[model samples]
Target: MRSLVQILAAVKELRWYYWGIIICSLLTAATSLLTPFIIKEATDEVVASLQGRGGGISVVLWLAVALLIADLSNTIISNVGGYLGDVMAARLRTRLSQRYFHKLLTLPQRYYDTALTGTVISRLNRSITETTQFMQSASNNFFPMMLTLVASLAITAWYSPWISVMLLVVFPTYMWLTTLTSKRWQKLEAKKNSHVDIAGGRFAEVIGQIRVVKSFVQEKRELASFSDHYDATIGLTRSQSRYWHSMDAARRGAMNLIFFGIHALIFVRTVQGAFTVGVMVLLIQLVNLAKQPAMMMSYLVDTAQRAIAGSRDYFEVMAEEQERDELADPVVGGRRELAPDEPMIEFRDATFGYEDGVDVVHDVSFAIRQGERVAFVGESGGGKTTLVSLLLGLYQLRSGQVRVAGHSIDQTPAELLRGSVGVVFQDASLFSGSIRENISYAHPGASDAEIEQAAREANAHDFIMGFEQGYDTLIGERGLKLSGGQKQRIAVARAMLKDAPILVLDEATSALDSKSERLVQQGLDRLMKGRTSVIIAHRLSTIASVDRIVTLKDGQVDEIGTPEELARSGGIYAELLALQSGSKQDRKKLKNFDITA
Candidate 1:
């Protein structure tokens, strides 16, 4: 019921169109009712003329003409009303689709952390399609069906109250039976939807990582798993269908029996002279008209239930809390300038975690001066990436504050804060597009010359120029067509084009081959110049040139000093370095610490 109200409220802005449909339906109902009365008059006129007491065939001819006109008018009004309903349905679809997409955009990153991309997309498609179709069906058919039923009942009651009462029983009984099964049907549908969503999510994941699946020889297993979900849906559908049709059959049988009595009542009344033959014909036609809505009751209820289910799912996502935009200040034009003495990035006693009471980074305090290159080295899952995420304002700290350019992160707009930082992750994460689009992503308005200049600085221009289309060359999904080195270089060029005041190199060259690493590192070097750079790398050699290195251990700041100072202090940094040294002496030294080389 709540979902139905929400669906109605969603399309309230187009009430004028709805009103037009209502008017057309009313006219159609009135015109349709005229047909039975006209037929009765024509029958009576023919009978009177045949009995030699009529005003001849002229009256019947005129009634025939009137019937034709009513039929034509009914057709036109119904068509016009259908067209209006179609337009309204389409508009509702557009309105709801745009709102859903906008909500997806405004949602926080944390929402995506546990959301499946395929499931999210599936919800949008299924919910909107079902809702729109139901709306269209209701507008085009439901109102007319209802109006015809009501008018038929009133006319039938005027002739004989018993027939009208019997017709009324048909509808309420059918509806009650439908209402009994609707809950169970909807539950089954929801369960089926779960299976389908999971399958869809897995389908997308498999397609996205087809190479992994193939390489692992799990193609058969994946195919079987995918088929299993559909099989489960089929099973649920069988039960759902059986339950619905069984109840529908029972409703229909009861309706048929009542209608049988209605037909008998009309016939017997005419035979007993209580009703004229013409009146009997009119009542029979009215009964047939009323039967239309009664028979259609089940279908309408089915559509309503599907729509309610879909709307409930759609509104569930919309009801999710969106990121608060009012709390952060807006960015003006370009990046804000920072004073030379100001720390470009600051984290004071920062603590954070993905889950409550499980802090990933604890009591971590640090400051990076403008243009200073700092590196963070730690074991896997030691909160290295989490810190960078916090710094970039991707996640809020638990108890402490992080500031960028003297503005607290919590008070700064995410876009404004992120606009001041350029990051090159381990994965290039490039979309499928032309080289020009990928390179100009960070600065879409960049000129050809500016794009080339950034690419050249990243050592990508030469390789890109070698292609037939140069910057126009198409790179497939995630830059699968390019070598690891080429992709990283493009990412570096992107960061370079951004020209933000701060840079973060998160294992930027970790995945590249030695030769590719050299090329990408050259680009990283030029990109990092004059920026407050935060580096996270497992390779100690990569950070050898950093001004300072902060070592993290078990979610705490284990050491913070110059690279040389931390190396000699024999903490997590020295242990990591010794492990990477690959010498017998370094391997023997690992025994002194709680680590293995």
Candidate 2:
């Protein structure tokens, strides 16, 4: 009920439309009610005329015209109301979609870590679609049905109070039955939705990683898993449908029996001359009118239950806490100046984990001076990427703080903090778009000359020009259309175009062949110049030129010094350097520390 109320409150802007729809519905109901009364008048007049005591055929014709006009009015108003309902529903969908999209953007990154792309999309689509459809249906049907039922009962009561009493009795009984069915139906729906969401999530994963699946030849396995989920839903549906329809049949049977008694009573009263034949016709029509709502009660209950379930799902995401933005002073033009003495980036005793109580980055501390280049080197799972992610403000620290450009990340606005840094991840996370669009993603307003210049600096200009569309060439999803080196170079170009004061390179060139690595490394070298750069690399040769090296082991910083100093000191960095130099003895010694080459 609260979820339904929230849905209504969300569309307050469309209240006038709702009011108009209600007015039309009321008017429609009023026009429809006039038909039976007009028929009753015409019938009595015809009976009197046949007995030579009334005005004759002319009165019947006039009343027939009145009935036509009433029905026409009812039809026109009902259609107009339906049109307004449709418009309201479409506009409501737009507003709710925008709101949900905005909430997704503002949600913390952690929310997405375990969230599946397809499941999230499915939830958004299904929930909003269900809610919008229900509101539209309610606007078109609910009020008209209620008004017709009430007006019919009131008129019936005027003629026969006992008949009206029977009509009233049908409602609560129908409602009680529907309520029971709806609760069980909603539970089954929720369970079905869980299976659907999982299937949808896995479907998207399989499609996106189709290449991986094909390479490993797991097509049959994935298909079986996907089919298994759907098969489970089918079983549940069979049970759910049987239960719903069976209950509906029983409810309808009970309603028919009660109406049978009411009809028989009306017939006996007319035959006994307690009521006129015209009055009998009117009462019968009114009974049928009242029955309409009672018949539709089950359908309305089903729709309402769906809306409630969808609303709960939609609001669950909306209720998640948004990322905090405490912008005391917004950074002007997306960059902040750093004092000469202050570090360009600093992590003070930083500790963090993807989950609580199991820290991935321990109490690590480091700082990079302005324009100094540093590289983080360690074995896999050593928290190098995690540390860089902290600097990027992607995750909050479990303890301590990360300051970028003299602003504490926790206290700074995300846009301000992130806008000051540029990153080139190991995977070139390019979207499905043209090359120009991807290059200018960070700075959408970048001019063509600026774009070409950045591409040139990243060594991507020659290859990009090789294509027919050059910069305008389309890159498929995740840059699938391009080679690994080409994609990495484009990512580098994107980072260069951002031109932020701080830079992060997370194994940017590690995934490429020797020739491709050289090309990308050259671009990295150009990008790192005159900027404070934090690099994560497993390749030892790349960090030789860096001003300092930070080696992590088991989430703690084991060594922090110049590469030459670490090499001489024989720490983890030294052992890694020796292993890379093909020293078998060093490999055996490093294995004792759980460091792999």
Candidate 3:
């Protein structure tokens, strides 16, 4: 097992509290050592005065003073340790959030693409809480207890060397035995942590896709599956409790056996008459005090080991390599603009594969000339979005290359590429803020005039102004309060605000009503007037004026040309147009259904 040292090193920001928590615990240990000495003095002094030496009052009074001092020491030390413990706990929780939250955002899209949102949520919640709790549990009672235990054993030896030797052997043996017994539980906690994440993620996904789940009528099955996992989690928790109880039961038995051993040693020493009755009483008190520390030391070790286990989980996450921004010496980034005289977009025999190794896209070649509108038309299983993703440099190609403005995306800085392009995705995300805030999300400092103009271009300004609060009204999550067309237009307004040199529209107008769609399409037409635009259009008429159409089938480019040229060529593009032109709900509608499959 790796030590918790590596995990502890992660809190660069809270180093002072980490050390403070430990040092204060040691102070408590020092206060505790006074306990046995106080008892010993009080016992012997009273015994001597009662027997012969009758300075009884003063001697007894002196013993009382020593005890009072011990109590004061304990109260002060314990409180200080407690304060430090709270400090450590508070800082640790803040640090966990800082580390994990930033890491969550930086992780590649593919990581989330395969994970369950619930599982990530559970980890974020439970894992972070467990880690923070470890800070308190390891420091507060646990630390002070361990120090007191070892110190008490040493003090016992100073009083009676032989008795101290016996205690020393017993403590280690008891710990070894208990540790061996509880092995099952440590492994169980780790396994439970992993399973919970998977289960949580599954539940989150099921809930997020509730509409689909209901469409498929899998509610009963989903609930049953979750119930089984919930039961398993409960079973594991009980098993862990049982193991600890059994270990504790055995430890109590060991404590009793040690006391018996002490009594037997004292009986042999009684013949000397060197130690008084009072000394015997004092020995009993010292031994009991010593026993508690030993028991507590074992508990401290348990707390530490458990923390180490929990820390192991936190370390696992921090250990996964982060995707660092590789932009080096060249301060300039990949700026999106038209080349002197060439295509604005180019894929030179590109190849890319996801973590699944399914080869979602393979060797492909295509180009979109400057000031041209290019539509990627495809049937089901075709890589329309994937192709755009490559052009955007989101997923670096495994082989070949992609270039924008005749500059290689692989070689260009990500910041520059991001700054150059404006995109309106199929699932446009809206913030839970005012309409003004949501539209200006990409460019927070956009002027009011620029924002209003962008809204007008998106054909959303009129509806937005009709609201009582105008642009200040909140949209809520995913814009649920707004109509579908409003949300889509809001998204279009956001993209328009960016005013990037390159524009991307993936089913941008799919959610809008016919009238709104026409208005927004006109806004889009103006946005695309001179810029290089890549569009994924389901409507046949929308792409009629585009410079070229690239037809895709099963991840391969089947044809590329103007609508007239492709129609004349009698290729896949022509067939798709023929179907789309027949009815509003024609073969084109069937093609849209296949995209998700």
TM per candidate comes to: 0.92, 0.94, 0.87
lDDT of 2 by residue, 1-597 (tens): 689789778779999998999899899889989988998898889889989988988888999999999999999999999999999999988998899999998887889998999899888888999988888988898778789889999999998899999988887888788877888899999998888889899999999999999999999999999999899999999999999999989888889999999999999999999988899988988898888888887788778888899989999999988888657775566577676789888889998988555898878998889999998877777888778778877788889888887778888888888888899988999999999999999989999999999999999999999999999999999999999999999999999999998898887887899999999999999999999898877776677899999988889998999988999998888887777577677566544333221
Write down the TM-score for model 1.
Answer: 0.92
Q: After superposition, how far is residue 460 of candidate 1 from its true place, in Å?
A: 2.5
Model 2 clash pairs are none
Highest-lDDT candidate: 2
- Model 3, residue 230: distance off in Å is 0.9
lDDT of each: 0.87, 0.88, 0.75
lDDT of model number 2: 0.88
Task: Name the better of 1 and 2 by lDDT.
Answer: 2
10 residues in a row with least lDDT, candidate 1: 588-597
Q: How do all the candidates rank in terms of lDDT, highest first?
A: 2, 1, 3
Query: Best candidate per TM-score, number?
Result: 2
Model 2, residue 306: displacement in angstroms? Answer: 2.1
lDDT accuracy of residue 400 in candidate 1: 94
Q: Which digits, one per residue and each the tens of the lDDT, describe model 1 over residues 1-597?
A: 678668778768988998999999999899999999999988877888899977787888899999999999999999999999999999999999999999998887788889998899888888888889988998898889789989999888887888889988887788788879988999999999899888998898899999999999999999999999999999999999999999999999999999999998888889999987788888888888888877877888888888888999999999999876745454546665565677888889999887555888889998999899998877666788888888877776779999888778888777788889999999899989999999899899999999999999999999999999899999999899999999999999999999998999988988888999999999999999988899988766689999999888888888999978987998888787767677886776544332110
